[model samples]
Target chain A: MKLTVTIAGVELKNPIMTASGTFGSGRDFEPYTDLNKIGCVVVKGVASREWAGNPPPRIVETYGGMINAIGLQNPGIDVFCKEDIPFLRQFDTKIGVNISGKTIDEYVEVAERLASEDVDLLELNISCPNVKEGGVAFGVDPFMAALVTGAVKKVARQPLIVKLSPNVTDITTIAKAVEDGGADAVSLINTLIGSRIDIHKQKFILSTRQGGLSGPAIKPVAIRMVYEVANAVNLPVIGMGGIMSGEDAVEFMMAGANAIAVGTANLLDPAATMNILAELETFMRNKQIEDVNDIVGVVNKAAISP
Target chain B: MNQSINRSRTVCKIISNRPLVDQVFEIILACPEIVKKVRPGQFINLYCRHSGRLLPRPISVCEVDLRNGHLHLIYAILGKGTEEFSGYKAGETMEIMGPFGNGFNLDSSDGNYLIIGGGVGTPPMVELCKQLKGKKTIVAGFRDNPYLVDRLKQYGDVYITTDNGSAGFKGHVVEFIEQRGLKGTIYACGPAPMLQGIQAYAKKHGLQAYLSLEERMGCGFGACVGCVTKVVADTDTGWRYKKVCKDGPVFDAGEVLFP
Candidate 1:
């Protein structure tokens, strides 16, 4: 049997979701994927207001990864609901809107507006740092996470999933605060803050100077954080970071995440999500696993008597 | 836009790889899948065979012999990627990841089509001309001789300008456009300075112009967001940033926010 997951009473065919911003508007990846087969698609983060994003030099490539300070450039929620959502409706898969707000009121207001729309879930991205404030602010502090999650929960009748940032010192403390504030579920491991200087240019590659680091370089860190957060909260945890293959996705599932999201891998291959799904099925079949859920957090191992 | 294009890496053989000019290579790869659907102004990200090569390099598809399933890439030896590529022999193979990036809009409804190119920018213009298939005038600029004269015949109604006057008109491509009283839609690609010159002249004459920008890119797709160019717009999203590899390597000339 296939793995199934429920978020706020909505059934997802699988437990894998594409992280926001990595997958362009759903239309870009639809050709590479059978949308109905995947569990969900997280659209690019839609700020309460449209964002122009950072200036040029917004991205720098590290050895195995990249850093981007795109500053949440997006068409606002209103445009998303009006212009973008219609396309998502055509896909049989669940559509999750990743939202960012610069202020508490903005979060509540956007949530209230989105409640009327047909989004299956709301992924509150409170970790974007390149913006004026709200992103990293809400994500870094326990109090801020609670306040923002609570504010959105008040107006949002739909399922709310707070996406946690990896920049925090204590991710569990922040995750606990959001859970306390009434968030239904949570996703862990947004990009870590990083920057690279072009020594030859004698300047930062990104116009913003600093951006979020992601890709295979951050996978181990993400797995650790997801394990920590899953241990801290009862909510279903969505895990991601440096996930390039289906085997990588299975590793995250074994690391204690209920579901996984693929981010940087999508950059290398637009058909990454579908490719991962196929690889996961093949792994499950080869391992003689009847259901995917049986492998989720199947990391308990007895010490070998050497 | 319902275009379903994306990126991939294919191990392709170098059918015929040779230098077109000093340090400029004309590499023909046997990539059947990529060659079949390639349009003008589109490019490929080639992974060079060296650890020192940091990322894949972008080279515009200069020509495509579709019937033969061959794609030609024209590039100059500027970095490790191209430098390493210069060493590869015909029949040797390398991983080619592309036919990535949006190309020029092929619509030629406007009567008088004007094209401007400088250096390597001339390659994409060749493809654009093939697509235009209309009455279009080309104003090509190069820095020196031999190079300008060698490729001038490929364009239609060509106006040539060389910095040293070793070629046709002794001025810039933009100067030639102004001197010739050029009009209608303009499509251009070149170094930033030349593009800036063309954009200014086009804006002054109220001509619709599209420019293909060359920005240093890491991932030649939307994923890295490395190749973003700012555009002037009238909305809250004051800056319109499009991925050169995803949304376009070609965009309206006036849309570019000249940096």
Candidate 2:
């Protein structure tokens, strides 16, 4: 069975990759599972300079998932290149570095810096909802999103994947915008802007009063958006948001995603990617499917007929 | 730090899950792997099987019976996750990831050890008092109806205080310590207000104190970087984020900013 899927000229052993921000350079999870077994490990979002992030309580549990306003805290690019990259290079799996910034210049600088690095892919994060500056700013507007994508694509040596925000009304418009600007691929849906109030305290649960919602609760919305973006753009689509099982990954593939990244599920189970990979393989073997790519965009047309 | 990084994850069977008071409960797990490595202030990220509750609950190690291979976890039903844990019964096995985070630093000091705890924070102190070598005095504060007094008594001189004066002292635990004029190396785990109060008292009396902080955790290991506490950095205008899970659930009272 062929599990390998190529995205923007980079060949992954499998289509399974850990979503950015959820898997932190694969260090802490080394004890629970081997990093090489999975297709790729996308490290946490890193900026040109260190960000202190927000103050606690930054995370809160909702009904089917959790909300986080982490503000993309990370050790600057120098530290990441020196420490994180070498550590990740020891593993056999491909490495995808998730890059974020407050301004267009900052994004370009980060892309330029990682251009000479050992990473296989660069995921430009223009859609982080927690931060006040730069995150949702570039994401909410199609022109700004395309501008940032074009700027990064000019300097990035590795293939660039623009992570899309779900806060906007029309996601396909933004996907097409990034595609028009020369983006190698696009990943969605980042996180929906959400909030929860503490009834007894009469205050917001998150310190920031709002956060990005991720987990099982957001899976259906993610699938629908992925389907839309996949049909709208020529660029390869990486679908995410609340993927918990191998079957869920398969569903994303059916929705026309070339690959799937597991985010909140990693926080729930440290070995989630490995388990999902095993389950995906088992599913293929059981169904007598030889190539995994055969199932991509295989959803029945009549199912969604009005 | 590197040695502590790869500590094993275990699926241990629950021996008992019973309530101690109105909202608090004690859970004993039959996992020798985790019991062998746990220290006074260390914690375990307990996985809950309930639907929709994905994150693991970070519960401090209350006690460790090495002989019987039982790890004790004392936690309160603060939210939906703990509420699910409250329903867990004996014979059910759950996956636990820790023995993570740095425990209380056991130094060879020349003073007496004053162990203080408030509310749900009292659990970790049970193990600390039991392991300390020198003179120990345990002071526990509760809103009302104290539990685990007998277990604490085995380690040190136990002092209890409740909000309604139903127990040993009438007021807060910090006030009780001040009233007794106890001066020694202090260790504490409690609500932010209580820890802040203790920090002030420790500064006034010039006593060395260690405090355990609680934050909403993601990975329960250092990876997520979700559980961060502000600390003094080396620069002039200095405050940087440190992982509460990796750097500490316990930090020196002098270095930590309670706000």
Candidate 3:
């Protein structure tokens, strides 16, 4: 059984991509695993202009999770265009550009620029915590989400996947709004908003009081949200949050996700992307599945059905 | 993309075995691949046994002996993970990866180099000394009779300072630097206060200074941006962040924004 997946017009050998921020522009993890083997590689988050990111203590490790406030630190759009994106094009794997912005125009500007070029997909990441305006603001509000989506949709020539933030009262509403605004697909449950305090230091480990949480701890919430958004919106859903294993990947697939992105897992294991791809293949071979897409939404609700 | 790194290692010995000090022994199986690649300020990540240890421990590669194929790692018994690492011995293997991350870039062109290291931080400077083949003065500070300086005598000019003056210099390493009229580039590592003093001294004299910082690292590699040192850019905002594990474990003293 071939575990091939095509999301929002881009073909993926597998659904496991090293999430936007976790994997550094294909340089760090290139040593551990074959970059071409694992589905697509979503490079680091790129902003319309250059960004220096946040202050010190960008990340903290909790019991089962890690909190990060890495404020979308990238070399900006110009550098990405001239330096990163050009280097990324050399790889055979699908290249998805994750874009973030402070204003709707910034988002559109980045999307418009990316659109002019040939990219497999564009993921609108609107969940950065360190930024003041836009980011989570656009994500939490369904109207703002649609507005940004609509703005980018007008000029975006490549497949647009609106990455939905999990920091909303009702994510389903935002999901539908973005779908209505013309998103080809949606990747759901970006890091949940959370914080950790140190008793000894008597202050937050992260200089920023709160940070977005991701890792093995957030998998359940991510899956539930993916299911919710999947039910609400008609677009294909890309699910992710603490997907560490193939079984976890399958769980998301059964929960109505068309594909999944591996975020925090890659940090835990250097070779996680390729490892999950091989594990997914092994799973397909054992289950005797013909096509990987057929398993999407194939929920095992034996107890619930009975 | 190349699937394997040029250098890699495995932890052959663990050290729940108690040493004289509150330290753990993570004796690496073979140091050849790692030792050959490691420079002064580089570190190795010892993958401890999966008995509850989730994060790999980042220890300064104290001494690398390519001939014996052993890299000695002495870590303070901080937690359960480190305590467990101190116990394991020969034949038992733990995943060890490295000679990873950028190291100290020391340029001793003038041959007039001043080296200062505090406590456990002195070990890394050993390699830096080996590379220096000229008039170099080493000023090492320790709490009491920590076994770092006694063995470091063969490197270059050796000067020791204990907190209680149980060692060489009665005061501090900086005192020795002041008394000796140590000039030229200064390379320092150790506790924050010592590094800060060195930074201030360098600033006063307008001399070049570099310092290696230690942070509570989660990944040792850049993946988990846990270990971070505050750096003040000379620009308008006057400050930025750089990963100590990646961007530098060693940096120009003038570059660091001391809190």
Best by DockQ: 2
RMSD of 3: 3.1
True contacts kept of 1: 0.22
Per lDDT, the best of the predicted structures is 2
Name the runs in model 2 displaced over 4 angstroms: A300-306, B1-9
Candidate 3: residue B183 Cα off by (Å): 3.3
Regarding DockQ, does 1 or 3 come out ahead? Answer: 3
Model 2: lDDT of residue B124: 94
Sort by lDDT, top down from the best: 2, 1, 3
Two-chain DockQ for each candidate model: 0.32, 0.46, 0.34
Instruction: Please list the residue runs of candidate 1 whose C-alpha ends up more than 4 Å from where it truly belongs after superposition.
Output: A7-9, A300-306, B1-11, B45-57, B77-88, B94-102, B109-113, B131-139, B142-149, B157-185, B216-226, B236-239
TM-score of 3: 0.91
lDDT for every model? Answer: 0.80, 0.89, 0.77
* Local accuracy of candidate 2 as per-residue lDDT tens digits, B1-259: 1111233446789999999999999999998878998998999988777777778899999999999999999999988778888999999987788798999998747558889999889999988888888888999999999999999999889999999999889999988988888878999999888999999999999999999998988878886678898888874458888889999999998889767
Candidate 1 local lDDT, A1-306, one digit each (tens): 577866667788887788988876666556456667678888888877777777776766686777878888886887888988898888778988888888999888888989889888999999876776889888999998999899899999789999999997799999999999999889878999998887898988888888888888889999888878877888888899988788899989887788888887766566777778877888988998888877766664311232
Q: Per-residue lDDT for A203-231 in model 3, tens only?
A: 98887888888887889999899888887
> On a 0 to 100 scale, what is the lDDT of residue B88 in model 1?
92
Work out how many backbone clashes candidate 3 has: 10
